[model samples]
Target: MTESDGDQPTRQRWILIRRSISGPDEITYYLACAPLDATVTDMVHIAGSRWKIEECFQSAKNECGLDQYEVRRYVGCYRHIILLFMLVQAFLAVMAV
Candidate 1:
């Protein structure tokens, strides 16, 4: 598929739909590539795998001070994230001991 960008037709992303077995709601997804071996179920499964990582991020923000920043500068934000992640790692290490 192509998208009109000025005078050229650029590559356009296409979406796939997956419906729940028990609910009327559906999930729409897009892939960077269409692998020959992957089916719709595989695509959905792959997409759903990110939820675990997302939940982990949420847990860090909620419990480990991952997002507890009040800085406005870009460098300050970066520093906050780096420092907070290090602090979280230390906390986890102490917990494991």
Candidate 2:
């Protein structure tokens, strides 16, 4: 693709779709197109992966007292995050049974 500053049509993006599988007999979707050059399918897949991370952040903020960490140092932040990850893993493990 040529980078033309004065081109509007060349700046457009297209969307395409495809089927995604989650589990047995379970099918989902993905999208793809060309223009902006990123496929919608890939975008959906990326977003789906990130959604779990977003949920983890929300859970940490809401339930793990993550905001209570007052120290601005990198060590403090890392310590807090490690502790929270351990706590979340334990919580999920317990819920699995």
Candidate 3:
């Protein structure tokens, strides 16, 4: 429901609770819950997003050598990544538009 700051990725969390009843005369009920409340479909979405990001990381690190930039200064690094992202955004916009 909330977007992460800047270009940072979003994180998903979920929790689930379930109850079961069994036995004879006196039925006994037990509760089982998962820490994450998300359903199977939601989990699949999270996993797919993670995999896509991982693929991007691989492409950037291995193919583009994104981290190989010679910018050692904080400002330089920030500017470099920002420009790279901007270019990517522009490219996407052009393609979509």
Which candidate wins on lDDT? 1
Worst 10 residues of 3 by lDDT: 27-36
Off by over 4 Å in 1: 1-14, 18-32, 70-97
* Tens digit per residue, CA lDDT, model 3, 1-97: 3235477635434433223346345532222222334566665455446657766655555545565667668897686774685466556557768
Q: What's the lDDT for candidate 3?
A: 0.53
Q: In model 1, where is the ten-residue run with the lowest total lDDT?
A: 28-37
Q: In terms of TM-score, which candidate is stronger, 2 or 3? A: 2
Q: What are the clashing pairs of model 1?
A: none
TM-score of 1: 0.48
| Candidate 3 backbone collisions, by pair | 14-36, 14-37, 15-36, 15-37, 16-37
In model 2, residue pairs whose N, Cα or C atoms come closer than 3 Å (at least 3 residues apart or on different chains), thus clashing, are 16-32, 31-40, 31-41
Model 1 per-residue lDDT tens digits across residues 24-91: 58655555444444566766777778777677677677777777756678898676775677678668
Evaluation by lDDT, superior candidate among 1 and 3: 1
Query: CA lDDT, every prediction?
Result: 0.66, 0.59, 0.53
User: Could you arrange the candidates by lDDT from highest to lowest?
Assistant: 1, 2, 3
User: Could you tell me how far off, in angstroms, the CA of residue 38 lies in candidate 3 after the best superposition?
Assistant: 3.9
Q: TM-scores of all models?
A: 0.48, 0.42, 0.37
Each model's backbone clash number:
0, 3, 5
Question: Once superposed on the true structure, which residue ranges of model 2 sit more than 4 Å away at CA?
Answer: 1-38, 79-83, 92-97
